[model samples]
Target: MTATAVNTTAVDLEQPLQDVESCLNLLGEALHRRDSAAIELHAASLHLALAQAIEQFTAAARNGTVPASLRTRLMQAGGRVAAQRESLARATAALDRAIDVLMPGEPTGLYGASGKNERKSAFGGSIQA
Candidate 1:
């Protein structure tokens, strides 16, 4: 697999919301450009960052109320990721079906009176008998 470098040090854990927003923007650009390697790397980094942010915020919320705007932004980011995941799944399923049709698996057959399984060609000729 190809590796894509990301500057994780640039992500501010203190400003989790903004960090997520920045990562989402980068992810959007990567997706738009169809950069699969970058996308995979970003997606993993984003997941880890988001999880850490959620845990930190959850702990902080026990002390005081979390801001409404921050919660809203997190919700929006989650929705976007969910939509992208669904789209990717659909595309993957379509591609799998196309591949199955184009390159089918081995054919099954029965042995004839000659104790051999016969095979035929597309041109109406016996390939094996």
Candidate 2:
């Protein structure tokens, strides 16, 4: 009787996943501190780490089923990313609203070139009826 052994070696995703998580944490810290330089650096690092993690994960998936623990960690990292995005969106909207309130704009009503409110028409013609 002949028996065949299967290669149970799995891809090492722990380091790649950890690198991404570390980058995310550093980026968060930079953002919190409002350090423009650190933010830029950490943002670049985070981008690279995320790309590497994706490549590793994709390759692993192609080869075989990725372990559940690694998948859970990846999902957690994705959740953090989503949360950060949503928070930034909310803050941006609030800031935009604040700016709009502070800096008022002139209405687009019918006004003459000399800054006089006058009744105009749809086209260049007058609407004096």
Q: What is the lDDT of residue 6 in candidate 1?
A: 16
Model 2, global lDDT: 0.78
Model 2's TM-score against the true structure: 0.71
Model 1 per-residue lDDT tens digits across residues 72-108: 7778988888877787788789989999999986665
Task: Compare the candidates by lDDT and give the number of the best one.
Answer: 2
Best by TM-score: 2
lDDT of each: 0.70, 0.78
lDDT of 1: 0.70
Clashes per candidate, residues 3 or more apart or on different chains = 0, 0
Colliding residue pairs in candidate 1: none
Off by over 4 Å in 2: 1-11, 111-129
Query: Per-residue error at 59 for model 2, in Å?
Result: 0.3
TM-scores, all models, native as reference: 0.68, 0.71
